[model samples]
Target: MVEDPLALWKALRNRYNHQRTVILPRARYEWTHLRIQDFKSVAEYNSALFRITSQMKLYGDTITEEDILEKTFSTFHASNVLLQQQYRAQGFTEYNQLISVILVAEQNNELLMKNHQS
Candidate 1:
């Protein structure tokens, strides 16, 4: 469950900030605008996907990321070749967003575990 949307927003901002620094030649335009234009960012890009997942979850779609990876890996997944190619060309922007969320959650979980262990 999402504990705090504000925290999530901040974490996402930080991730984008780091990416902007590490990947030189960052997009000249603002992310919000770019998000509108290209439908990038977690909220803008994956909101619908997440909503669908949430609905599916209510209906027993409890597939984990591992399951997703396994399925994608197994199918030789070319469901949307053009979209896949575009994502690849853009360096897996959606995947990066997902990674950012996972990293944040993992870090938070580790901290909580450490606190509990103490």
Candidate 2:
């Protein structure tokens, strides 16, 4: 066990860098194929995004937020055309803002359905 936190972090980062060199190609391919419309709900999509981003950051070296968003948006499936249009039309420059819009839309849709049910 390393007594120094910084040293431990450095050691872990070095190990990750070694693994990343071997694994990044497969990881990048998988990320490219991941599409927003493949998920049935915002929550599911968000969870998958979180998982991918966290793994990429931890083992695939540091990626910029813009790069992540670009990779994510690159895979937007046909079913998400409307959402894609919204994104383009609104010109959202940040990834988090796009996530917020999707989540809020999901919540609104759920509330509308519940209201109709009542």
Candidate 3:
């Protein structure tokens, strides 16, 4: 949906910020009761941190906007596929709601980036 690479990069960065600031903390808190040694708990934390690092690296000082956009889009697509599989297997009813939320968040991010560019 994002035709401009630079704009897409900015939008992705904003989306990452929103997730880190809003979603990750709440998820972490809700799952904190689980034992740290549990595979699920460790995997969840690692996955979240991996995503954060990947997003940060994409926008890091040395990376070009074009590279960031390409890499971010590739990663996003892969992640979405994996998420879809997981949702289908474990959270069928919640899958659509989650996807809808993600789409709206991405659209909001794009709008914010466009406003900033203007």
Candidate 4:
């Protein structure tokens, strides 16, 4: 008699409401504590950001591009204050734009270091 699984799905969703109690706070904690400098690479930071934000979204949180960009800017390493200011001055409205630029910069820095080692 369960030809339509819609009712079953709804029941599952409602029954699992307690999951939000567990997941939402954990997601928020991870999000707040996330710092780009903690990761070894831009890609790793990006991956973790998406994962945390997606979890927050699942729990009815709105994670906007501006929020993401601001979070990234604010969490940069303290030693890179000038670099952070420069990136912030770029006025990146989208997270992807800023991240792409940072990724390219990281690659260029690595290349420069390799050249220096030669």
Candidate 5:
């Protein structure tokens, strides 16, 4: 009954892509709503962000820097509030700078945990 395997493949691909596009906004919304309190560790937080971004990247030119930044900053946890305030005081208004500060803070937290254990 496989009269046209290539055609069937194209149809399935189209359906999958359509579904992906349909949910892109919802995915971004969930990501923006994700809070630092949701994760107990830096690895968990980073992994969640990585996964969401990887999925969104599949949409090619559709994802925007503003969207990513809004999600990244809006989901700040209590631990990150200090860094957020400090960065703002230092005039670090750029999204990239904020990401860097957050990553560094995560690394520092990891090191502190390791040292405490040792």
Candidate 6:
């Protein structure tokens, strides 16, 4: 029972450090294989990106917003080259910024599709 928060955090970190041996290789593999087009939806891809990156970070890998942004833009569908370029031009500083735009665009596209079907 550590009364100090910092000490408690350190204790927890030490206790779980051994899991790093098992987790790092798997996390790295997932990170390498992750691609946007593999997912059926933006949300699904976003969730996976975070999950893998969080694991990597837990094991001391440094993941930046630029890394995530480039990974996403590079994996955009071939037909979406212009769209990818447009997003890059926007210069989003964070993953959430880009994801929010994507989610909104997807939602708006769905609404347009529903209207077209009616």
Give each model a TM-score: 0.26, 0.66, 0.25, 0.88, 0.58, 0.82
Candidate with maximal TM-score:
4
- By TM-score, how accurate is candidate 3? 0.25
Candidate 3: give the clashing pairs. none
Off by over 4 Å in 4: 1-7
Ranking by lDDT: 4, 6, 2, 5, 3, 1
Model 3 misplaced regions, further than 4 Å: 35-118
Off by over 4 Å in 2: 1-26
Q: How far is candidate 2 from the true structure (C-alpha RMSD, Å)?
A: 4.1
For 1-118, candidate 5 gives per-residue lDDT tens digits of: 4469998888789768676767677667767667656887645776776667766777553556666555655666767777656655665545567667777888888899999999
Question: Please, what are the lDDT tens digits per residue for candidate 1 over residues 1-118?
Answer: 4579998888888767665344322222221122212433334434543444444454444746554333222322355456334434544334444445534655687899999999
Q: Candidate 2 vs candidate 5: which has greater lDDT?
A: 2
Q: Which tens-of-lDDT digit does each residue in 1-118 have in candidate 4?
A: 4456998888888989789999999999999899999999999999999999999999899999999999999999999999999999999999999999999999999999999999
lDDT at residue 43 of model 6 (Cα atoms)? 93
After best superposition, candidate 5 residue 113: deviation in angstroms? 4.6
**lDDT per residue as tens, model 3, 1-118:** 9999999999999877665566545544533332222323323533553444354444442434444223323333453676445534553243235445545655687899999999
Candidate 1 deviant stretches above 4 angstroms: 1-42, 67-97, 101-118
Q: Extract clashing residue pairs from model 1.
A: none
Ordered list by TM-score, greatest first: 4, 6, 2, 5, 1, 3
Q: Report the number of the highest-lDDT candidate.
A: 4
Give the alpha-carbon lDDT of every model: 0.45, 0.75, 0.48, 0.95, 0.68, 0.92
Better candidate by lDDT, 4 or 5: 4
Candidate 2, backbone clash total? 0
